[model samples]
Target: MLDIIYKYQNLLANIDEYIEDSKFKKEYLIEQLGVSRATFYNKVKKKSFTIDEMVVLSTILFPEEAKAFEIKEALRQSREDSKAGKTRDHKDVMAEVRDKLRA
Candidate 1:
């Protein structure tokens, strides 16, 4: 799966275009993300996104073609995450905290 994405990095670089233009008619991406078509559509329903989601999302949506600068930045970020002892997104973090608080 990753191999296929690497092969189509150029195309993925324009994922936003593909998604917007065809309403994410691209089945490969939908499948690769392990998300249902409804999940994709749900995101489309939103009018805005958190800045962080925008960053990782751009990369996830374009693993190959995510500009050299962005790819370098993301790599540096992942390294930083490793050094920090663990890695997870803000949404995951908040969910955990919220669950603990509820408990």
Candidate 2:
């Protein structure tokens, strides 16, 4: 439960940063998210949102940010798996590094 909360908080924080960086107005975001201005404000104030809402907002409002979030989540999962002794093979590590470099 705590992990879920933390993940939501991180996503919300990232969304806020993206909004600021993109110079998006709150009214625009509300419209994009298909919510009333007051509803959007209330959700932001309470930091409570459904996972579906998050995904939808991320997908439609800021696709680049959504991709960034996906990458971040992949990296986090890889780290956690490594910590649990699920480390990848050396060749896999090299391949991943090469892919990153190529990117």
Candidate 3:
């Protein structure tokens, strides 16, 4: 619990720096967020973005990190599914992939 709290605090503290260092333009972010420039700045200054908003911003600002996280999550879920005997045969999977590629 404390670790989670600390991580959240760290994110909030460094969000402005992240924005400044991001490759994305501020205008692009504002458009994507559907917020006025003033509103976006106010939220960043106050660290008052909601959890959903933070998720969106994080996904936008750190797409590679987000993708890696998703891949890790998928791997974890696949492991759990395999343990539960939810596995598909390799040959069948490859056949499906080939069919999709041909289409």
Winning candidate number (TM-score)? 3
lDDT of 3 by residue, 1-103 (tens): 9999999889988999999999999888888888999999999899888888888899999899999999999999999999999999999999999999999
Among the numbered candidates, top lDDT falls to 3
By lDDT, the better pick of 1 and 2 is 2
- The 10-residue segment of model 3 with minimum total lDDT is 47-56
**In candidate 1, what residue range of length 10 has the lowest lDDT sum?**
47-56
Ranked by TM-score, top first: 3, 2, 1
Question: Model 1, range 18-101, lDDT digits (tens) per residue?
Answer: 466643344654565556777755654652333454454555554565787687898999899899987778999999999999
lDDT of 1 at 20: 65
Total clashes in model 3, counting residue pairs 3 or more apart in sequence or in different chains: 0
Q: Of models 1 and 2, which has the larger TM-score?
A: 2
Segments in model 2 whose C-alpha atoms lie over 4 Å from true places: 1-6, 13-18, 60-62, 65-103
For each candidate in turn, the TM-score is 0.33, 0.46, 0.85
